[model samples]
Target: TGKKYNSAAANEAEEKINIAIRVIADHVRAVAFAIADGQLPSNGGAGYVIRRILRRAIRYGFTFLETREPFINELVAVLSAQMGDFFPEIKSQQNLVTNVIREEEASFLRRLDQGLQLLDNVIAQTDGKEVAGAKAFELYDTFGFPEDLTALILKEKGLDYNKAEFDAKLKEQKDRSRLANEMTTDDWVILTEGNTESFVGYDQLENTVSITRYRKIDSKKDGVQYQLVLSATPFYPEGGGQVGDRGTLKSINETIEILDTKKENNLILHIANTLPDNVNTSFTATVDADLRDESQSNHTATHLLHQALRSILGTHVEQKGSYVGPSRLRFDFSHFAKVTDEQLQEIESFVNARIQDHLPLIERRDIPFKQAVEEGAMALFGEKYGDSVRAIKFGESMELCGGTHVKNTADIWYFKIVSEGAVAAGIRRIEAITNDAVKAHFAQQEKALEDINGLLKNPQDTLKAVVSLQDENAKLKKQLELLLRDKAKNLKGELATELQEINGVQFLAKQVDLDPTGAKDLAYELGSLGTNLFLVLATADEGKPMLTCYISKELVAEKGLNAGAVVRELGKYIQGGGGGQPFFATAGGKKVEGINDALNAAVEFVTGK
Candidate 1:
């Protein structure tokens, strides 16, 4: 159902204010859920989605509701108190949700301060009774302000906004996004009576199943695909952090290759290249044994790793998200600080010990969700569960899972942690290899070691040899820095000797052979030593001209000279731009010869001499 907004008020502006309130009420749910689901308000991906939603809601309250300071964070408590019973995850993750929202709110408030000026500019351009959709879009696209915020402001001015035109612009942008991330599908056509599908993939890899439904999809982005559904197949659909199984379906007359198995709202869609010739009859479905075996091994390793993380990084660690494939497994969990190298080694040892023990997986099915929770089977927050769920218990490691796993932990062979680092604000991700991926990993590491040994002439102590080289390089760097500093001190006198007076302002404009930092240092030295000084140091290092301006505090007050503004004007001559405080500024440009002209321009612009 669409979000229902029910608040009404007496004042004319109150109508707009209520609009913002309603939007905020509706959007806060998504923000709350996304945060509980472990997605933070970041600059990209799903976090970007959360950020946009929060900003939109805040923009409404900002424009119409007259809410200036961070107010949406307060509503988090109201949301928790209201819906906490139904969705307890929000209550559990309330602090995280509130903190993320508050941080995002504070950030957008800073943006809104800047955007208000942009909004005014957009509003001013449409002087007529109607604000152009293009103008409304500018406020949103450029400034990141909500469109409704613009509408509310326009309504206050008795101006109508072009919504239909705005929708077109919105659709154009959506089309661009859709094209980039497009997945076309065809309408399903039923071939059998039943709507249910079953997976017997745990016990068997091959089965003869009848086509329940089929569809031919032609996508402009992905091209043509034939999706078929079987009554009861052994194929496992992609879900629960596991990739879809790739296999084939065979009819009596022909064999149709199954590209991938995926689930969309409990419907397992078998993506294929071609349709079966005889849709009425049953066909033999087979899953590639080698692929599922490797996947299961990695999936089991992920479970062991999850337990190890909780043991290593405290019980605060929970599954944030994961990706299990034939090659490797990537596990994301909630933790504050970085996992140290020693901690990772310990984690690896823990998992490898479990693998070495050959712990049997105690697979329990049709277990009541509540009973399973009582049994201490760790349930992933935000994941929807049925009345009865499957729980995989490996000694101490227990989790509610439906994805295929190894019969025993020993099947994983070996576990190697590839990398460990932060994924978000409070989330850490660990990518690790299992089974054949481990063997491949070791092979690559061995090869790299061999290459390094060959490069180092097979040094008996490679670590000590490398350390000695690094020490030598550091000493050389220190010597070069000292030499450069001494050279700069000498060049300062030569540059200062060329000082000339213009309109009672002690002006010096000369081309110097120095790096940017060196040039800046020289300018500060001269400025600190002199009085009534207007210094402009120009340099052309590697044919890139740069200008630095330093004006005295007295002249800045008397002559109204701004060093930043002066350098910016000088920058135009050298095809560049810059700005700074009243006393000091710097600019960089392309034209080498223009450095002298830029200095002359600065003198004429400030002294008119």
Candidate 2:
């Protein structure tokens, strides 16, 4: 049996359904990839990614699949069982995941139902004219309604929609997003096999290396720079948000300055201005010993800080990102809010305590990733791991890492936190330094403090000295305010006498010598005197002209006047624009001569002859 329906409406509905299906399929594939990597459904990076995907899928089903609420749960359960071996945590947390998805789905359905009611209002107000596809798409994108749902509701109301136009708009947005995230890389050239790079420079400063493979790349700022992969280079590649290493790569005859070392794929590429003339010749690879030593100290200090955070804050604190360079180390971790001053002090004290203890660093190579975890080594949240990883431990502080480190915690000399703040929604970051950098940082601080103390005659207590000076400054400020108020009062009476009657309204226009704030206060006081009073004042201070306007409540209604519009129109003369309520407004101008013209315009507006 066939039900008579509009052929166009049916086709539009089918196209929307197809697009939703494609979105759902892409999400499913992303989940499958996460599972293949042995990542579990926990409250971390990969876990959050999976949860977001599942919630989106459930919302899509409610909007487009036209199935009941239980359909998404059933689909997730089926997928979980098929992939349970790869991610046992998914099955273990199935009930929790389902409950979360169902709750989100119910909430979104309620929002959609409310949005449909709003749509009906828009349609009724629009009076049967076909709504633009762009507007309809905006409603869907911002309010999370499927396009099919939009079309369905519009069809029920006897209105037409351009589904193709909506799809085109959607596609354009997707194209822009794709372009923003697209990354390109050139293919790697392999030079040697079985020549794994080592990091002996942590203990020793220099190493012997032969140049392996090198290539040239063109960048926006610097053109035609060479990138070389060396055999047994000592440079550490930048990872976990730290800047790369930079030093000298030299042969006996020629020297190439290494600007940076970074790892791409599994290869460490050394960036330089040019490659050495003899590609096959062996050379000395040297990292800046001072920088390397400082970096190692900071790197180990970060481990201590990480452990301190877990002990003082909670075990929930996980490393989100890190940067270990020659100068400083910046650490990012998962935390919901700002680290309090007391907590930060505690963390600082704890790391310094460990440094004082002189804890020896334990390095283990070629450890199985699973075994490392079983031994309670902390793996970073967003890092992708392989079958094997290197573990570094400073007593209880154990983590899977490959960065260079000091032989003992005492080598750190000192740890100092430079800054701490939020990096993202639930992530906080701490930037700190160690060794010579810490010494240098404190030296700079001491010099500044000395300068301040000298200016204050080297007070016995700096804090009390500064507090007394601040109190005196506040008293002086209060006296200045009182003087300004007395001046304003005198000016107000003189200004009131200057007011003239125009078109049966009290019109006052003048170019005052007062500042903008004073002029505004004067105008407001004048307006408070009586009804139908209009005031406009302009002042030229420091080669700039400022204007202020005020109108009484009755004058605004009688003249149909808007001070905001008047200020906007007058702003062109002054080269600045501003707006305010009908009762008050202001503008600033670069041309001092334009103040008179603006005053004339305001007078004409009030007179209205």
Candidate 3:
């Protein structure tokens, strides 16, 4: 075995190549671990942090290692194998992590290719060695290309960008973000000494309580807000994917409407736009009964849905995330493949079947976590648990949850899956409706079908009618293409006779009564007639200007005539630009009036006039 070992980090290695290896190795862990901790790559907040890190590794591999395909996702397996025992979450979510990284890699690589082309255009348009930061920032803002990566590419070409200008643009963006998300909170005005606040929303919708603490909040988004902590609350604070409860706090003098509720530092804070008239007096903490009932139905339905997915799609299904609200519920779970229409129907039926069974809720409060787990309660990943936990059970579905739920499954009435799709690599999301929402969904769908039927003149079989209509449209489209082809062929014969011998080259430049495609077809047909043929065909299709150039191979080689250069130069007449091979090219513009001007200027290229 004669295998040679080279003293190089990478082929055609540089100092940065060694740095790239370290960067990829280091940044991939941050990204993988972040995803494991229930954060996915997104455009904002903590998600943005992970996304930026992943992009850095991708760019490094793309530029230095010459990696063109998705390789970052492959690294997840190695990472999982190395740190699996220490951090079991990564090992368990290995496939999810891999798929997420792969999708992101492929998506960004496409963006990278687009950015490269845009960067090249910027370089061509620039007056000096320094590229404008505004253009670079546009690439970052519009295409998600990193600015440092932009700088690196420019540096490799013996060029540099304006750093100070880039910094100013970046600062402007950050300033706008700060202004949008700006928030300030005043210290709590303590009405009581100890923290006696607790959630009593499970048993009652209304409770007599005293104000324990209150604070004022100021934010640009919501303007002014107040946070009040009651001695005991019937309002449920936002947690475990369920939105905070909104209700009213009624004192003797006035009723203050709670806008939202949130839990911070183990304190249940009821958010309101205004404070009570008398802070020292008692108030009845009442939860919004209608909203609460709606939320509970969706929450309970979510549990049944989870059980159904695991049962029907194998035990690999796990709760990745969820949202329970008044109108609808969104459930994110771990699954390798897309849930087919058949599977969705099966899952909906499974949940509805449980609802029909009328399973009563069996809740255990303040049980040890180990005991609840040992009792076959499913604990969701990425959810924190203490020594003691509350378990909610309904028939065969049981989970360690603190969210409010229906007293009985029959309260849900019905469950319907509205949509299902992939959210990340191995993660799929299902949006569903229950009770009143399901009713509304059915009404909307029925109305849509009725409208469709009315449009089809009350056709008995609407599906068959639609298929017939599509077939007729397709047939008409084929007939239109054939007519256009016949028209182009006839036009080519007339244009060939009108060709002028410009400097020993067969040249013709004219506005054509055809589409851009037809112009292209006509030009190629004329080019194949003889050698030294240089044709420039201009057209305005439905008020949009387009230019097509076709130069024979003989003319291109003998006279060095480039069709790409011709169209690019001519494109200025129409206030647009484009390029292609030396033999054929195309350009599109917004102004149709410029078509004749572009056709007029085409002869100058051949004549050098």
Best by lDDT: 3
Question: Per-residue lDDT tens digits of candidate 1, residues 1-609?
Answer: 122344656666667665876788889988988898767777788788888888888877776666678878787898899989998878988876786677678778887776666665455445678878877786788777677666766777788789988899989998998887666666788877766678888889999998988888877666888888888889889999998888889888988888899997778889987787788887899998889989899899999998998898888787878999888899988776789999999999999999999999899999999999998999986678999999999988679999998999989999999898876656789999899988988899899988887888999988887898899999998887777677778877776777777778778887777777777888877776577889888887777888888888989998888887787778878988776788898988887767767876766855666
Candidate 3, residues 1-609: lDDT per residue as tens digits? 012234473554555567777788899999999898878887778888898889989998888777778887888999999999999989988877888898899989999988887787678778889999898888888887788889989999888988888889999999999999999999999989975888888999999999999999999999999999999899999999999999999988999999999999999999999988899999998899999999999999999999999999989788988999999999998887899999999999999999999999999999999999998988887678999999999997779999999999999999999899987767899999999998998999999999999999999899999999999999999998888889998987898899999899998988888888888888878887898899888888898889999999988999998987788889889989887889999988877788788998899998899
lDDT at position 414, candidate 3:
100
Lowest summed lDDT over 10 consecutive residues: which window, candidate 1?
1-10
Residue 140, model 2: lDDT of 79
Each candidate's number of clashing pairs is: 0, 1, 0
What alpha-carbon RMSD in Å does predicted model 2 have with respect to the real structure? 9.4
Question: Could you tell me which 10 consecutive residues in candidate 3 have the lowest summed lDDT?
Answer: 1-10
Which one is best on TM-score?
A: 3
Candidate 3 regions with alpha-carbon error over 4 angstroms: 1-15, 82-90, 498-516, 530-545, 553-582, 588-609
- For residue 232, model 1's alpha carbon misses the true position, in angstroms, by 3.1
User: Per-residue lDDT tens digits of candidate 2, residues 1-609?
Assistant: 012223354586666566556666566545544543434333457676775675566556555666444444444576678877887756754553444444445556676776775575456446455877877887877776667667777887788776788889999999987776554435555566666655554455578898667776765456678888887777888875556677898888998888888988777888998878887888898887677777778788888999998999887677766788778889877666689999999999999999999889899988999999999888875478889999999877689888888898899999999899965435689999888888899999999999999999999999999999999999998887777667777888888898888887898888887778778878877887789888888988788888888888897888887776677667667777666788898878788878877777777786664
Report the candidate with higher TM-score, 1 versus 3. 3
Model 3, total clashes: 0
Q: How accurate locally, in lDDT, is each candidate?
A: 0.82, 0.75, 0.89
Which model is ahead, 2 or 3, in terms of lDDT? 3
